[model samples]
Target chain A: MIIIGGTATNGIDENLSKIISVPLLKVEHKVFPDGESYIRIPQHITNQEILVVQSLYPPQDKHFVELLLILETLADMKNNKITAIVPYLAYSRQDRRFKEGEALSIKTILNAIARAGADVLIVIEPHKEEELSYFGKEVKIADPMPELAKEVSKKVEKPFVLAPDRGALERAKRLAEQLNAEYSYIEKERDRDTGEVRIKNLPELRLSGKDVIIVDDIISTGGTMIQATRAAYEHGARKVISVAVHSLFLDNAYEKLINSGVKEIVTTNTIPQDPSKVAVVDVSPAIARKI
Target chain B: MIIIGGTATNGIDENLSKIISVPLLKVEHKVFPDGESYIRIPQHITNQEILVVQSLYPPQDKHFVELLLILETLADMKNNKITAIVPYLAYSRQDRRFKEGEALSIKTILNAIARAGADVLIVIEPHKEEELSYFGKEVKIADPMPELAKEVSKKVEKPFVLAPDRGALERAKRLAEQLNAEYSYIEKERDRDTGEVRIKNLPELRLSGKDVIIVDDIISTGGTMIQATRAAYEHGARKVISVAVHSLFLDNAYEKLINSGVKEIVTTNTIPQDPSKVAVVDVSPAIARKI
Candidate 1:
């Protein structure tokens, strides 16, 4: 099997190399002055099962388009089978059209990727499981949150798992179960017009003498994490940390999170930011076994 | 001509109805349970010269995509001509790929709108004129800065035009020439890695008893405006006011600007924000003559 990793998949590739003995080939991506992207596989991989990994995070459309282009190039290069490993799928939040005249952008994005030539697709903890049909791939991975939390717990002692909001409670619960730690979720009231969320009933879950770890599937804007950290500190948490499957870290998000009271944030190498720490889980091995 | 307006368009239809004897349509947009968007136009607009006015300011992408879908629906309804009047165009800052592997998303967005079936486009004082080619339309217009400055000058007997940065000196000079006011530009130093900018030099441009008007094309974070206001107040200005063509105010931007000692903030109804004051310019008259 030949493996190609995007900005997010580098960690998965490293872990997979250590787990199994396989030859890997990395794709080099560059952009021309005229604003076109160029992608090339350095080594020949005729009839090889290729695993192309990428995360569709913020700037969702651009990253999704780049991934499609990469898949198209690999297909044309005569790769036997193509598997897409997307850690954090963008447009997942946009699953359905709430009103008339709105395009089902998530469906459209998925169709673009499938049409570009991905035979199997793997996603980790999608916002909604029903979105799986959007992809024409045969394989789908759901909820890698347990394994990720287990890996995080191994490094730290007495880690208390936290969910920034009730919407993220399921993932936090699953992670806490795996880590054998206490788990609690914060409630939030969001302003419909502005998309501004206010955390409520947060100080109730006092973590006065515990090492807290905020766990979520994705961190976009980092607003929730910041609010959670402030509440945690006010309620007397010893130290606060963050771990997520996807660290989207939107514009100025990293600095905001760090300045908001998070001692150290750990996340998978999901979106190619400097603060992305801890690469505990790898999907390449699972994909290889499934295929 | 058929006009569609909403909060995003700031009742532009009401203004247009006075000039032309055409039916005015108001667009109603709402969010559904599954976090999807819904849009409805109250009147029939088939085979009409349709003008859909909207601004993509804060909640930038959501409002932008909503406008695109509305345009698509209008095209599907067999409108004879579709013109999109976006006064406050967001993501224009990403015109160039500042870093490696970054996409020129502004162009992609323009292409998406064009593909969605907008025959002509109108924007007010885009950050750069070179971005006009990115759109596949001709009905572009400059901000009514001169006219607006004259009106503002009438309010304050003695006024001085100040450019927030050297990049905006031309605009300040133009406004100053129109109002016959003194003009000055701030020298700024931006940290490349963090995107943090600081004023490098203040050359003591005395405004001891004069009303200072800081002018710019757009205000996204309001950081520059905040610094400018502080500098103006420290320099003994009697009053400090901020005026911009497009107000792409992000989260907490308005509050931050207000707290930074700005006496009054004035912007054209480019973006539909409650804080926006003064709308001296209208593109409808100019666009009507052009088309």
Candidate 2:
């Protein structure tokens, strides 16, 4: 098997190779003065399994174009067994049209990806499962929650997993069960007229001296995580830590989360970032199991 | 025939509708919080001629993604006779690989555009003509030098056309012939080892009271144009004007060109910009002729 990394997935290619024991294919990604993207794979591979590692993070559109170019180039070289491992699939949030004339972005992006000649797609915790069914080709989803739970267990004492909102309750419950710790989810009530949101937690259970760990699929903008951190502090929790599968960290979100009193932020190496600042645990073990 | 304009080609849609006398389709292009592009045509397009006008300029990748989304959406809607009218086709410059393993971005982009379901393509002044034949589908190239020359004739007095370098001499000659003005091209000698460039102009030609117009296909960094303008000034040109098919205007390029003594700059409505400042001459007339 050969591993190819996109522009953003620069150093993770070596890490993936270490887990899977595959040769890495070098790709030269170039961006012109006009903001157009170009990529070149120095060698050609035929009749071999190829794995493309690209996380659709910021500059998602550019990375997406580069991904398509790589896929098409591989197809041109007659590589049939191509798998795209998009850790954080952009456009997964807009799985459904919110309004009458809204475009379902996820569906369009999926079709584009499939048409660009990816035989199989392996995504790590896509925002929506129903959107995966929309792709006509083979798809394998890798869940890193178990790995996240293991990391959480080693870091904190008497860990209590908390979901920021109801949408992530399943993730929180699974992680808590894996760690043999207590789990609870917060309810968000929004005043439609005023556009105000209130976070509600279970009144019976107390979080006084427990290390609270918040688990979610993605941490974009960190608004919900910030509120949840403050709520945990108000409930007299000893420590607060934020854990997510994908760390988008948009618009000063990392700083905002830290300033909001979260003890630490841990995420998988799905999207590349500074390792020292944001704790990026490896997800290659989980990915290696599937391959 | 139905014509639709993207975010960059806003006002130009109405102008095309007037020239070609076709109803314009409305497209709602939205960028989601997670940086995903969404585009909706609002109404279903059936068995009719469809034309989409979009320019791949700054934010080229996003516009390219949106263009693909629009094309794929049209395909899903079963629109067969879809034509893409990209006034400024990005990635046209990187038509071929400079190195052994470099990606032919234009070829990949063309294939992507075709797969996304464009049956025909219409472009104005793409950087290279040879690359257009690589597309399996039909392609139409429109040259609006006569129109740009007309715009220049009205703005300047006793105009003298000057090509930035040897490559653009054809454009300068055509525009000069149309305007019935004197024309000259700058000679560039590059040091093979050092890769340094020197611009040379004829010492015999005098431009003491003539308006000098420098014509080129694209004005990327404004370095060549600045040098050409300086050379024109040294030859005693009274006023200097710059003309291009596509205006990329990279990093302080507009300010650099203005500061270099160009009186005014004129470009076609290819790349989107403020009409009051950039002097975007309409290309609807040229497109209307092709339709």
Candidate 3:
């Protein structure tokens, strides 16, 4: 098997290459003066299993177009197999229409990827697994939560896991089980019109005299993380660590989270991550196992 | 047919609405803080023919995604028919791979639009008519050349049409015939690596003692137009006019062309043209005929 890393992959593809012990193929890519993406698979390989690693990070539209070009070009090359690894699948949150006559953007995007010719699709902890069904092919998820839990355990001996909301309680439960600790979720009521949220209740444990870790699938604005950390400190938690699979940290989210009194920031290298500021965990081993 | 205009339509849809005498539908669109596009079609219409007028201009991918969403949603709403009008089709210049192991970007993009549920696709003067074959469905082109020629005839008498290269000689021929004038093309050799071009030879008539109008399908960066205008002046032409169907005028192109001794800049309102600087010709009547 050979790997081809897209320009937006950050460093996850390199990690995957190291873990899988496979050679990474070089791709020559450039943008024309008119903002058109140009790519070429310089090496000649026919009937070989190929893996494409790309993450739809910021500027998602441009990255998505490039990914489509790569997939289409690889499909025409008569490859034995093509697997697309989009660790941070942008637009996954728009899996369904919230209102009348709304478009399911995630569905449209995933379907287009399948049409672009990917034999298998792999994403890391998509907003919902059901969205992958639109791909119409074999789908796998690289869950970094277990690895994140392991990393947290190495730092804190016994930790209580807390989910910012009930929607993410299961992730908190899984992490707690791995650490042999208690888990609970906070209740949050969000005003759709105003985009404001209010935490309804705190955990039963009150997190008193205990180290707490908050887990979620993604942290876009870090708004929830900030609020969750404040609640943790109010509940008498000794230390608060915030962790998410895909840490977007958009528009001062990292600084806001840190200012909100987070003891440590933990996130997987799903998106392009800054390890100096956040403890970046590697999920390549888990992804390699699935592959 | 009811018209639905995207935000990036640049008044073309309104022109289409006026020409077709159809009521335009209301669409509310916004972007989330996380940079996801959200759209809501407020009105309900079923079993009515729908025309979607969207121009894939600058920031092309975002507009393309919105087009897909609109088409997919309209398809689900049981519309009798859906016709997509993309005036300035982006990525059309990449119709085919110029080198081995390259992606046919235009084909992938066009195919995706069809897959997104556009029943009939209508584009305006695409780079190559052959690229539309990738749509794999009913297709129509709303050529604005005739309308442009008519408009130009009203402005200048006895225009000598000249194409920058042999590739666009056909366009020059059509424009010249509409004005009852002679047509010729310049020979140009382009350096693929540096994207530089040099005019090898001027027209046989030397363009002496005649008003020259240089025509092309699209003018991006205005590099070719500036060079062609200089060549026309060097040949002792009385005045030079630069015209194109889609006037991108990117990166100081407008200023550069005016400084290059162009008497008039005429272009269709294909890519959000600044009407003050260039003589904007309307092509709505031409598009209306096909609709």
TM-score of only chain B in every candidate structure: 0.83, 0.94, 0.94
- Misplaced by over 4 Å in model 1 are A1-291, B17-21, B40-47, B189-208, B233-236, B248-252, B255-259, B275-291
* Root-mean-square deviation per candidate: 13.5, 3.9, 2.3
- Estimate, for each residue in A41-94, the C-alpha lDDT of model 2 and write its tens digit: 888678888888887887798888888888877776784588988877888887
- Can you write out model 1's per-residue Cα lDDT over B1-291, one digit (the tens) per residue? 777774366665576666665667777777543233556655556888887777775555456657765776677567469888777776676676454334454665565566566888887777877776877676566456755675576667679999988889988888888888999987878889999977775657888998999999877778889999888877778888888876656667777888887777777666665744434455455345444
Tens digit of per-residue lDDT, candidate 2, span B187-277: 9888889998977648876888989999999889899999999999998999999998888788889999999998889998887666676
State the displacement of the C-alpha of residue A28, model 3, in Å, after optimal TM-score superposition. 1.8
| Native-referenced DockQ of model 2 | 0.46
Stretches of candidate 2 above 4 Å error?
A: A44-47, A78-80, A160-169, A181-212, A226-240, A251-263, A273-278, B21-26, B42-48, B155-170, B180-212, B226-241, B251-264, B272-279
Model 3 alpha-carbon drift over 4 Å, by segment: A189-196, B189-197
Per-candidate TM-score against the hidden true structure: 0.55, 0.84, 0.95
Pick the TM-score winner. Answer: 3
Q: List the residue pairs that clash in candidate 2.
A: none
Q: Give the TM-score of candidate 3.
A: 0.95
lDDT digits (tens) for residues A1-291 of candidate 1:
767775446576665555566655666776433233445556555697887877776555345656765676676566469888786777677666565444555665565567667888877767777787877567577555555765676566767888888878878888888888898987878789999877775546868788888887777778778998887777778888887777666667778888897877666554565634434354445444444
- The deviation in Å at residue A71 for candidate 2 is 3.1
Tens digits of per-residue lDDT, candidate 3, A204-288, equal: 6578878899998999999889888988888888889898999888899999998999888888887878888999998777789
What is each candidate's DockQ, to 2 decimals?
A: 0.05, 0.46, 0.64
